[model samples]
Target: MNGPALSIQTLDKVYANGLKALDQVTLEVRRGEIFALLGPNGAGKTTLIGAVCGIVQPSGGRIEVFGHDNIREYRKARSHIGLVPQELTTGMFETVWNTVSFSRGLFGKPANPLYIEQLLKNLALWEKKDTQLRMLSGGMKRRVLIAKALSHEPDLLFLDEPTAGVDVELRKSMWAQVRRLREMGVTVILTTHYIEEAEEMADRIGVINKGRLIVTEDKKTLMHKLGRKELLLDLYKPLEALPPSLAGLGLRIAEGGMRLVFTYDPAQENNGVVSLLDRLREEGVKCKDFNTRESSLEDIFVQLVGDS
Candidate 1:
């Protein structure tokens, strides 16, 4: 409440076989914001989450939740944190209501059936409250997991690959629910393989690769700085090869030579759009139509990780 929702300092991890899982990683989650952690597989996303939730021991460094040191004050720190893991490890025969209620009890909270009911409803799981975990479909079970995590009413929630195997509709539903959670003053930190998820939902984004945090910035800043934009020129006639005059420009033939694509950084003062058009006209290249598109988060992710 006084400081960041979660603060991680100089975190490090190494395994028995001498595998370095994390390398002096440090990060902080701003209060009441949706912070998305993006990384390729085995890039320490899960390990970072595990360390903060007291599942995996950090080889070095400190972690605090709402100003409480996680190691020295485990209970107090953990009480403010909730984790929805990627795996479905719920009891197979347990009813949804019972499972969620049991989770609240594990946190030593008083039984609040009204809260549980509303939680179920918020997750669209109220109708399935009486159904056992094994009897529900995959998406419904995922919802149950989220309900269980929020049963304790934590100030901070960590969602690891929340929509990995979910359908498109369910994924959208889950994202909407997360946004509502943020509106309720809950800090949500999520790891996702879907680049669009971070682009759409996150206020800030942190990129990790090879056990280190490569970069962290506001989503808009990352897009404007590192993201590229493309100019797609539709040619009136197909060309067998790039024209000699336009060869110096970073233009590529696409759509079976009927289109010329020029990619440039939007942050730069000169994007070369005018120069490209002038050069094309001078070279007797005719353009039928044209459109432009900004580079997506996926493109930024690939470029960042590739460079690192």
Candidate 2:
């Protein structure tokens, strides 16, 4: 509701090959909130993150991190944000402790071994701290990346595909750590392919497609705005086709006429379900059972991208 911790105003990016990567994208990430950017591959998510983190330069527009312009005040703005890249590009021979420590030093921060210790411990990387990067498992390496990102104590952190290719247990642990980070007052902006992760962790959701930001709103608001639930009626007997009298009701027959699926907006003032059932009885249609199912974020994402 207030001024966001990070702001992207009319952001645009174009590659040398004349491909547009971002198109006047405008977004705001609130302080102390977990914001998830959801999109398909090549949706410019990584490019947007790279622009804000000073990795890939934007062709146009402004990025402000907590009142500091990312371009003009590069050092100060960068010091306030940390990025955990999708790739695990840690130094193969460097110990986890050394690598995390080195990342902190890169930010021109004074040595704070205690902070590094706590970060590693919090990420469940303390036991692996002494192990070389190449010697650790893929999951451990991912945690080390997170620890390194938090090494400098940034106010904002970017996690790009943090749970990609990880096991269920590791993913759960990572989600728990993300919640802890938000509780610790770190504003987290993550780009993820896993809609479940966004649905589970994010306070707000932003959808991007074809280098354009389609929507950004509260997670619940987005879900409510686009989510749909269907009432399915299992017919006791199979019918050759839907009766002509029920044709105007917008119901589709399924399972070779043994089932009928009716899609209706639950938010509407009147669902008209009872009337439809009454009409069905008039048509001699009897249902053995009925149930409802809700749509998920994945459904919303596909619809949004398709429309965009």
Candidate 3:
């Protein structure tokens, strides 16, 4: 709590098969902030999370949780953290109440039925306390996982693809639960395929690509810096190809040449919009109408990872 919720300095992980999962990755998660780690599959998102959670050992560098070195003080560091893995690993025959209660005890916590009861209720699992995990639906089982994670009342929580493979309604419900957890002062770190999840929830986002952390910044800043805006012009007549004069102007023919799409950075002093319009006019290109659109997180992710 003195420095940050979690800190990793020059972290590196190399598997026995000579696969470099993480490459000198350094990151900091501020206290009480929702930090989203965005990356493509096999980009080491889960490997990084696994390292910090002590499930995977680092090959190099240090990881500190709340100012305590993770390796030197594993118990203390682990006690303050909770994890909801992407996998469903609960025992099929175990009742919801016993599963969560047992998880708390695994952390060496005393039996506090009141706390456990409230946690189960908060997750909407109160009515299903006596039900076996095998009988619960996918969504309800995910809720049980959440309750188990929070059984010890950790200060930091890690959710690995928390909403993967869930229905739209269930995903929305999970998002609400995450928001509630953040409101309760739990610093949350999540890895999600849904860029919208990060866009909607993360205060800050870190992008990892091919085992490297390519970018780390506040969500708004990341968007403002890398987000592209587009102006689409509807052509009066379709052209086979772009005019020669309009070359190197950052323009593209779309909709089978019935439209011209111009992408530019909004922060630039000259976004080339006027220049493009003037060039279009000089080229005798006729436009019936036009509209503008902003880039989404998915756009930025594709661009960044594509570049990598």
> How many residue pairs clash (N, CA or C atoms closer than 3 angstroms) in each of the candidate models, in the order given?
0, 0, 0
Clashing pairs in 2: none
Q: Cα miss at 157, model 1 (Å)?
A: 0.6
> lDDT for each of the candidates?
0.91, 0.90, 0.91
For candidate 2, write residues 145-255 as lDDT tens digits.
888899999989999988988889989988998999998899999998788888889999998998999999999988777777789999999988878988878799899
Residue 262's lDDT in candidate 2:
89
Which of the numbered candidates is closest to the native, going by highest TM-score?
3
Per-model TM values vs. the true structure? 0.82, 0.83, 0.84
Better of 1 and 2 by lDDT: 1
* Residue-level lDDT tens digits of model 1 in 163-203: 88788998898899899889878999999878888888999
In candidate 1, where is summed lDDT lowest over 10 consecutive residues?
Answer: 294-303
Q: What TM-score does candidate 3 reach? A: 0.84
What lDDT is obtained when candidate 3 is compared to the true structure?
0.91
For candidate 3, lDDT tens digit of each residue in 192-241?
Answer: 87788888889999999878999999999987777789999999999888
Clashes of 2: 0
Candidates ranked by lDDT: 3, 1, 2
